[model samples]
Target: MHSHPRLPPTALEDCYSDLRTDSPLDDNSMSRLGSEMRHGVTSVSNKPKSADAFFDAWIAHVNETAVYGKESIDPTRSTSYRFIWRSWCKYLASSQEGPNAPYTMANPLLAVPVDVSRFLASGMKGSKPGRAISDVTRRRYYSVLQRIYAFCASQAWMECSPLDTLAQQDIPMAEKHTGSILTPQQWDACTRRYGNPAGNTFEIRDHAILMLLFKLGLRPEEIRALRVQDFQIGIADMPTLRILPRSGPAQERTLPLDDQSAEAIQNWKRVRKDLAVVINTNKALQADFNDDRLRAASDTLFVTRSSMELAKVPLLNLVKAHIERSCSEAGLEMPVRMGPQIVRNTRLIIWLHSGLEVDAVAVMAGLKNRKGFLHLLDYCSESVKQKIQPYRRRDDDPVSVTNMLKE
Candidate 1:
């Protein structure tokens, strides 16, 4: 159907064709996927810089393909893909030997891997101002390029992403550090500062979210996946929130709502119901109504100001900002990463200190076993430490190391 199919497949393609065929992405043939990518697809007779031609095509492909329900990569990711592609184009324009020197290759398939590595290593900036971007950010950029190339390569547009040639070490694995657990008093202060009753609609929802994070130690995904029916108030002895397996590893568990959490959620539900009424009467809000987003948010527990389900980028910003503000107001030193994990970790620590069994806590937290709380072992008293001995990484585990801390 397109010109590029006549071109030869790379050596990797021959070896991995079976794997690609088995991939979920292969269900739609390139022709059936869309016509946008057909622009840069060249036969030997007509040549042009495929990167220039293919870039727009790639954007169209991403827009069309982000279709997985709930698990779908949404507009935030599509915006990011466009940003990275623009940056890549800027690098190409600067790297050419002369003004007329054609950008890299006529076929994007033959683009050099070193150039991609160099762009990442030199062109990006970190949040700390003067520094180059961190490895975690580098991995994100690497992921975007790999996704593009993998899809195009599947369609016979290119050999592989230039990034595939990079060494494993070039893009770092996720950083491994112990999750932080806050002091109980500091945790209580954070709750008071963030979760206190609020008159404002947005603040009421935020307050409810903060209470859940403090009490249940919920993952961000769990918060986003919550539905209206998941909040069981009259159905149970106490109001409870159901934590089900989402796109993450969190197992199914129904956690009883604390008095504060239950009240905050009840308040938020009132505001949420009020908003639906406002949209019908207020012509200004109704003027901008998005039927699709309204349908998506209809049963969702949490939503943005725009009446859409909360997205990944906004969720990160919301959680980070919430923790940072609460910590600052409570006069607690901020953790290096102010994300949901710290809140979850602190809640688990609270359970253990309150005399809950290590195995029981692990099951509640949906972790492998006591080893999931291995990092917290050093914080336990010797009596509590004995209970977790069977789950140690080694006989000389850190629970034993805590013994030496006092001696």
Candidate 2:
């Protein structure tokens, strides 16, 4: 059993007692959550002035900045960025205050080294959901902290960013954490079970969405942002989808569209037309159209019958509900956990099984590297494993290894 470090007699006992319980992070525990920043300034500022204040201010600043452009900063990512700052504050509060205090505050967040180590350790343990975070994300978190401290120091907030000294510390790349995807056979089963009815737009649309993700390996946001113009039937009559660039300035990709998905898209487009006046002409879309840049945006992509506005979460939930309903109808075990992106993994595995090169598969999936693709192999079924096995190499001898000439 781990004992509490050198703390006060009563506090030390409390820490140790709390540690004895299996759960250190109880929701009801006040100390674990940290003090909420009370806004009315104390004589020295009743509000928090130390680490928490800096992070809170930065979050507000960035969120406010996100509103200026035609494309707002992603709300989900902004929420996460805020949470990351809060996590930092939690780390700071729990650390030991050394003999010599550099600042006026009695306690600083964990010492720079300690928190950095803790963050890296937390990443390695696969504590974060959606599989473990990529090494890039871990590195970004660390770098973001270093910047936060630098920002504080520049403002004379703290003597220095606690992480400034960690520059020399080697931060190793984290192992890739891959997600699950359904196979072609599994997908065929899912679609047959869910879709195929005349008025089953719900199932058909979802099945199509899943198909698009599997066939194209589109990112969630890219899939969500799809518009009517993104669909194109090539001169050879091949259906194709133009996947727009993601967060950064990346090249858009034109992915081949499957026939079933194309038929589903046409169905959705028809339904979208019927519901346009009812759903698409909402205040939000009108607001969107007010901007010249957003004027060309269409209302016929993915949307909910509940509302005209294209909300990411609501659409995702609707898709999941349809899936569950289909599972019930088909007598298949309902997935306890699933997401829109699992199809991307399915596509990656299929590509590998079809003997496509890793680089080609990466390009098709819009992945910048093969690391995640390789990691995804872990989730593949044994049949897919066998299917994905490399073929025997052949030598060019101009002679048949086996001749049927033997009498």
Candidate 3:
């Protein structure tokens, strides 16, 4: 729960310099650099003329110094932290005695655990009334505040982190739901509806993506990060997928592709190449599209119909949309949530039930160890249990006892 000390400005300068020297800053880094610049100017405005300006400046300072400088934090994580902090600021501004009040603006950091707890329990602005935030969200809220207060304490801005008293026990998490994994029947029904690669460009892309998730056990982000070069189809052995390291401690792993998955990818690749040529030929369309991202056209496998690299939100939307359609077509109710994860869980469960060794399954699933696969045990059916029974120790197995009395 304790926050690490902030790196000195000089240290940050050196870090940024090293990053720049290693490779050109990607869009993510450039965005962070812009925020850092804003923070540098606003950090000096400690005594801004108005309460509104003071709060803005304080928030900016927190983002620049505490959030952005942490090289270990990914861009997605950093964005989430900033968003949670901003929500807190918005809640305070709406309060009568909050920091936005003319008298209290100067002492904006004067928050206690009680205030934080209330904020966590309160309904979010756009959410339904009486629908308090979930415990998981509450825990995240506590973490953001804890980190912010720890940073404040490190700066001597506050005496201590009020969240120090808060424990994991304070927030009651929901029990893990085993039903999140799709039943075999449901999986078959859904796949039968949309797994065909003979459809149009969008259909071909969705089919390929779903195959990667359901057949290859790939996470959504992994699918998004995949480049054309990552596919090793020409190998005489077997087609393989090289998953590059991105958001986790796990090292990059290469997984052999199943026949169906390889074929689905090949079908999509043919269409993707044709689409890219068309998009690149239209100068006006190409210019308009390329203006969005800093990088030139990438070799990423999944992309928009216009051939730009696929973004996170749209990729998720594609998964959800296809799943919903498939569920409707199959005359079955869609799972409460349908995403790439359901496909991944289903695939992993199938692998386990198919009698694949746990270590081998873990490697194919891009996990570091067998321990990470333990949670998926819930998805194992009686049939799967029967399959794995031979691997389990028997209760009546003879116990090995070493004799101490040697001749």
Candidate 4:
């Protein structure tokens, strides 16, 4: 006698089935059965949920649903979320569950409070290396775990989320690892003044990449993700490099390129064009290029030479080679492990010491706030600060300020 509406395509089959399952017995029949089975009619306790199982589901949901067709959180964030999920899952797996042989292949979902606590404690211990997992990473994991619990609770799988009660205990805050910002003298001695080893195309490109990183303060991932189209030479007739980060819901930023950076970029672009022409001489080059993009997700502005032929580890290997060769040949201090972030930190330090307005620096560095820059500011040397004081204020000399004060 009763009727129901059709389910939407997005509705789950289980939800639809639950809606459609008809009552098998009338009230009187159910009452008779209940009377017969009264002694055995106890309620079933909620089942335990494993962090591993929950994390697997969470990542799948994030990839498939959270970022599906959404431009707000770009590919970089999506990848970061994936990494965060994977790391947490590994931690949960390594940890011991509530007194039951650590849930190895046996009812991981039955994991309770102890497993969660152990994982958090272990993660905070910095047992692995290079400073314990950051507070930001821990917070992100906590949020993900909370979402997992919420999902399980919605499905009637958990009595309550472990995270709900764990809030009372304090997770130790990580000592902010201040990144060292190279002073102008340090930067010059290391980079510009050091001079390239014979100015090959490779060296030119590497220098350009270094300039972009240190001058603009771009994230490694952001730099890696940058495409050739992202570089514009003549925007507003001023030589510029526009770094469009694929991480937020914002427009692209145009950086006013210095003469050195502009020249470096031009040199690299010419080399890249020549490289492309050589590669494309082969009839199958287009197909190879597509395959390269698919494999690496690196339609990158800066790419390794013979990048099409590289295996999975080429980028890091290329970086190592560059650092070793450049430092050895130039007689400069071997850079403290060359990576994209180091250059970015270098630029932030340069701007802060030069007395660039914090907000303006943030905008140029393409940061959402001053917080990240403030962290980088911590590494500046007092000596560098003293040297940079004269460059900080553009509009007034020391004498002018003194005369104005006298009036």
Give the runs in model 4 whose Cα sits over 4 Å from its true position.
Answer: 1-173, 183-185, 193-198, 276-278, 281-300, 308-337, 380-407
- Ordered from best to worst TM-score, the candidate numbers read 3, 2, 1, 4
TM-score, prediction 4: 0.47
Off by over 4 Å in 2: 1-176, 183-188, 193-197, 200-204, 249-251, 276-290, 293-300, 325-332, 374-377, 380-407
TM-score of 3: 0.50
lDDT of 2 by residue, 20-139 (tens): 222222344324233431111111112245665666655553455432111233444666555555565544443434423223332333244434555554523233556866666676
Give candidate 3's error at residue 10 in angstroms.
Answer: 46
Predictions in order: lDDT: 0.60, 0.52, 0.58, 0.51
lDDT of 4 by residue, 1-407 (tens): 22213222321223223321222223553455443332232332233355455555544534555322221334444555445545555544444222223323333333444445555555433435677676666655555455555544433343344444443353334345456544454456556432352398777776776666656776666666666666666746677666675776332587787888777777777876667533453335456755654434334567666663323344455445555555666576776656555656876777766867766776877776454444454465675434333332111112111221132
Q: Report residue 285 deviation for candidate 3 (angstroms).
A: 16
Pairs clashing within candidate 4: 48-109, 49-109, 50-108, 50-109
* TM-score for each candidate, following the candidate numbering: 0.48, 0.50, 0.50, 0.47
Residue-level lDDT of model 3, residues 1-407, one tens digit each, is: 22323322321133223211211123453355443332122221233444444334435554464422122344444566556665665665444344343333323355544445445656233235566567656655655565555444433333344454333344334334344677666788767755557888878988888777777778888898898888887658589989998866573898888888888888888888778543463454455755534233456678786546678788778778877877777788788768888788878888887877766877888786554554565667775544433432111112111110010
Looking at candidate 1, the ten consecutive residues that score lowest on lDDT are 395-404
Superposed by TM-score, candidate 3 places the C-alpha of residue 250 at a distance from the truth, in angstroms, of: 1.8
lDDT of 3: 0.58
Greater lDDT among 3 and 4 belongs to 3
Q: How many residue pairs collide in each prediction?
A: 0, 5, 0, 4
| Candidate 3 deviant stretches above 4 angstroms | 1-134, 137-179, 193-195, 234-237, 249-251, 276-296, 374-377, 381-407
